[model samples]
Target: MDLTNLSYEEGLKELESIIDSLETGELTLEESFNKFKKGVDLYKYLYEILNKVEGEIKIIMEDEEREEDFQLEG
Candidate 1:
């Protein structure tokens, strides 16, 4: 499957499948390494998306808090 083009949920599902395949001890060494690489890429992509979302939320909360403080001091 093309992990790069996958949606977040689809990428996560595919990563889980790769883990299961590796844990089964059925694939050859090369195949295992390839799956592992794909899993890592998926993980990195998900992490980046989550981090950006978190950062945006943090900025919004900080702005709200500043507004509240100004209201209190006015």
Candidate 2:
């Protein structure tokens, strides 16, 4: 599966797997570094997606309390 094309949940799961692999110290240094890089990329992608969604929600319901609403102007 292509990490870049994965949904938020899928990316997170893959990132968790990468973390497990790194923590186990079973992979060669190069492999570990590659996986780590991919994990970071996935994490960033997920975070950005989440931030955008949150922003959209805030925009959509500016007046109402959004569950545990906090000011999120962006």
Candidate 3:
């Protein structure tokens, strides 16, 4: 799966599918291990995306506040 191309919601859905598969207890040991690894990778990718979005939102909010302050001053 191309994590970079996936949105946060897609990543989350994939992660949930992985969890369901793991819970089924039907996979071979090797299959389970591979799925677990994939889940971890998906989790990390999602975390990074969330943090980046949060930072961008904070910056945008700060810019808006600065603009409002400037307008008030003027």
Candidate 4:
């Protein structure tokens, strides 16, 4: 699946739908496998997004800490 333009919320919604469908036991084995694979891709994409955001937050926090330290020293 080409998730190049997919937002995190959209991907998450799709993953949830996949899980719901899988739970119903309605799809054939092949269909289930396909959904499973797509879900994995969505999960990875979401994880990467979260990790990037976390890293950015950490950087901002570190910068704030440095500024505070500099002010104290001055």
**In candidate 1, what are the lDDT values of residues 1-74, reduced to their tens digit?**
45557777887788799899999999999999998998898888888778988999999999999999999999
Candidate 4 lDDT by residue in tens digits, 1-74: 88889999999999999999999999999999999999999999999999999999999999999999999999
Task: Return the TM-score for each candidate structure.
Answer: 0.82, 0.76, 0.91, 0.95
Q: How high is the lDDT of residue 65 in model 1?
A: 100
- Model 1 lDDT on a 0 to 1 scale: 0.88
Report per-prediction Cα RMSD to one decimal: 1.9, 6.8, 1.0, 0.7
Better of 2 and 3 by lDDT: 3
Which ten residues in a row are the worst by lDDT in model 2? 65-74
Candidates by lDDT, descending order: 3, 4, 1, 2
Quote the lDDT for 1 in model 3: 66
Model-by-model lDDT, in order? 0.88, 0.83, 0.96, 0.96
Q: How well does candidate 4 match the true structure in TM-score terms?
A: 0.95
lDDT of 4: 0.96
Q: List candidate 2 segments past 4 Å from native.
A: 1-4, 63-74
Q: In model 2, how large is the Cα lDDT of residue 2?
A: 60
Please give the lDDT score for candidate 3: 0.96
10 residues in a row with least lDDT, candidate 1: 1-10
In candidate 4 the C-alpha lDDT for residue 10 amounts to 96
